[model samples]
Target: MKLLASGVFALATLMASSALAQAQAPANYGPAIPGVCVYYGAQTLAQSTVGQSVSTRMNALSQEVAGELAPYAQSIETEITALQQGRASIPPAELQSRSQAVEQRIREAQQLEQTRQNELRYTLDVQRRAIATAVDPIIVAVYQERGCGLLLDRESVYLMNPAMDITPTVIERLNVALPSLSFNRLQVPVDQQQAQ
Candidate 1:
């Protein structure tokens, strides 16, 4: 078993509730939680690298909606700009018709954006929960081994006692014990109702 630093912020954030659980633990009852250690872990660096891919996936999903709406957006903006530049003067009949059409198109784009946003948001929420679930068993193993009373997100702790640091060890053990959720899973569109 490799040693793990428990205070890495990346893993810590996901395990913050465990920190509170630690505080509530009975004092001097070490026997009850043998092999338990007070620990934290970082996975931010790794997760951030994965996030770049996630970002790209989100941008790609936006493409379809954007494509559908681009002509409307572009046309409206062009007409507005032309009006500002005095490039075109419209009679009241044409002006009213153009204004209504522009409003309708704008609404369509806004609706599409809202739908896409909801789908992506739901997908992200599920994915994070999945990753957090994957890491839990490793946490339990380390807790059992170290006689740990609590676990915290590494980011929350400012001072690292080398004696207490177990990040690398935990990470290694976790890699073996638990398969990581996709470091970057592309979020695709879902129906607006399903997204909700």
Candidate 2:
């Protein structure tokens, strides 16, 4: 009688456990499958008109700036070569002074280069903002059309199915809507004066 009772208890516990597992299934499963959209900013930017134009202008500007500093760099280099080649008898004190002067000139050139590059970066930021501004509407439209709630960066994604990516359409629409960065991309979506 005790053995039969033990078997019955065991069967009851197993049945209860199975029932609990089934009841908890809804918590682990989602109501609808979530899909993701990915965008590659660098690739899209490279293909955009604003990006190309910005790159071209910056390259030209860099060349011009390099030209301005090239002569001083050559002078320093030539002095070093001359010192090495024994073209002149350099006294220890004189050599130290000359070396310091050359180093100073190189530092000045480096500072100028960095400053100009920073200025170029500012220019690029402005251009990028313009491009992003222009692309927003198209991105919104595409998002709406595709029923996507979220947009993701392509770079950070570790592992995702290729079917989830949405960069191509975004790139196409961006190119269509924004041929250049000269245009202001935003307009009044809602009347703000009325709110005041």
lDDT of 2: 0.63
| Clashes within 3 Å, all models in order | 34, 0
The lDDT values for all models are: 0.53, 0.63
Please give, for residues 21-89, the per-residue lDDT of candidate 1 as tens digits.
556655544243333234443342243333333434544545554675677778879866765565366
Clashing pairs in 2: none
Compared with the true structure, what per-residue lDDT tens digits does model 2 show for residues 41-78?
76567656656665555556556656777887788799
- Per-model TM-score on C-alpha atoms: 0.57, 0.61
Clash number for candidate 1? 34
